[model samples]
Target: MGSVWMYAPEIGYGARQSLVGFTVEAADGVIGHVDRQQDQPGMQHLVVDTGVWKFGRSVLIPAGAVTGIDTEAQKVRVAPSREEIKAAPRFATDSETADPGYLSGVGDYYLSLRS
Candidate 1:
């Protein structure tokens, strides 16, 4: 498998396009909207603001989990189910977004879903 931080080749996410505000959908249903994105080559990810769903909490979704991108509909589709995404390692925005160890743990959690 490729690095979880990089988008799958088939995801077709344009480098210049912004995903902020786009709806994020898990395999089973809508989860949230993209609050922001980290597109630093090897560390791409999306910070999704799950309003009301998780009590306004935000979650970090690695790019590799993205199954598709629909610009017209302003949506992003991910491979994991809602439950699986909810169970991912908690994202500590203040301290963990740029922490290598935290990113690795998050990557491992997503990678395990493929198996």
Candidate 2:
């Protein structure tokens, strides 16, 4: 399996392109928009701001979960469903996001969904 932090090669995402403000869609439907993204090698991920969807909560989605990126439409699609994303480990603070342990837990959760 490929690293969860790296976007799948098939996604064909340009490394220099900014995904911020792009709408994010889950398998079911629209979930939110990309508020921020970490493009650093081995740490790639998107921080989605789910406005009014989950009471303004934010979720951290690893790049590997991204199934597609439509630059023309400014949209990103992930493999998970809305419920699956909502059930993911809560993204609380930047401090936690920086913690190796916390990130591992989050990564493990997403990886498990593949099975």
Candidate 3:
């Protein structure tokens, strides 16, 4: 269990906002819809319900992975592919969401992709 470096905001960023019900689009295609979002700087994340795509499993998407959010279209664009997101650390409950160790794993996973 270890803590990874916090996300560094690139190209600046808007105020932390909710993305619930917003459709998440991967580079290839739509992945799922946002069930919840944590907009805290450095600890931001999205709780996405994969619907029928992954048998309704929910995954945690780090906020840094988000490229853009289109309020008009109600869509959130993510940089990671569907497969990457599918393989990300799962978010089964609120407790897991708050767990530093779990979050560290997620952070490590995403960070590994950039390396």
Candidate 4:
């Protein structure tokens, strides 16, 4: 098998933090909520909510997508800009992520976008 990233949830997030929530930057600073997390040690998946990410149609975020992990806040900040991630393949909240074929296409498009 290949390598994978890590996530820390034992610390938990902010009290007001809501899963499927969006991280908003205000005068105070950047704050957000958690929508859902895969959590399984070997598996990698994150379901960001559409409510926070208004632009996207879906919420499946690859584990490696994270740029930094706020162990203190128990939050994950993705490396790609919000717009870049939003432009990635977005799925409906009700529907599960598409098949590998779909992921492959998304990966290809995202790779091309980075180039």
Best by TM-score: 2
The candidate with the higher TM-score, 2 or 3, is 2
Report the alpha-carbon TM-score of model 3 versus the true structure: 0.85
Kindly report which residue stretches of model 1 are placed more than 4 angstroms away from their true locations once superposed. none
Q: Residue 13 in candidate 4 has what lDDT?
A: 34
Q: Clashing pairs in model 3?
A: none
lDDT of 3 by residue, 6-112 (tens): 23356244555557899999999999999987766567777888999999899888877777888889898888899998888777897997788988898889878
Identify the superior model by lDDT, candidate 2 or candidate 4: 2
Order of quality (TM-score): 2, 1, 3, 4
> lDDT by residue for model 1 over 1-115, one digit each (tens)?
2579898887777778999999999878999999999998988999999899987889999999999999999999999999998999887574788677888899999999999
Q: What is the clash count of model 3? A: 0
| Top-lDDT candidate index | 2
lDDT of 4 by residue, 2-109 (tens): 122233344343333333444422122332344666554434556665453364344566554554555545556765565665576755652344355655654555
TM per prediction: 0.95, 0.96, 0.85, 0.56
- Which digits, one per residue and each the tens of the lDDT, describe model 2 over residues 1-115? 2489899999999779999999999989999999999998898999999999999999999999999999999999999999999999999766876899889988999999999
TM-score of 2: 0.96
Clashing pairs in 4: 19-34, 19-35, 20-34, 20-35, 57-91, 58-90, 58-91
Runs with alpha carbons beyond 4 Å of true place in candidate 2: none
RMSD of 4: 6.2
Order of the predicted models by lDDT, top scorer first: 2, 1, 3, 4
Clashing pairs in 2: none
**How much does candidate 4 score in TM-score?**
0.56
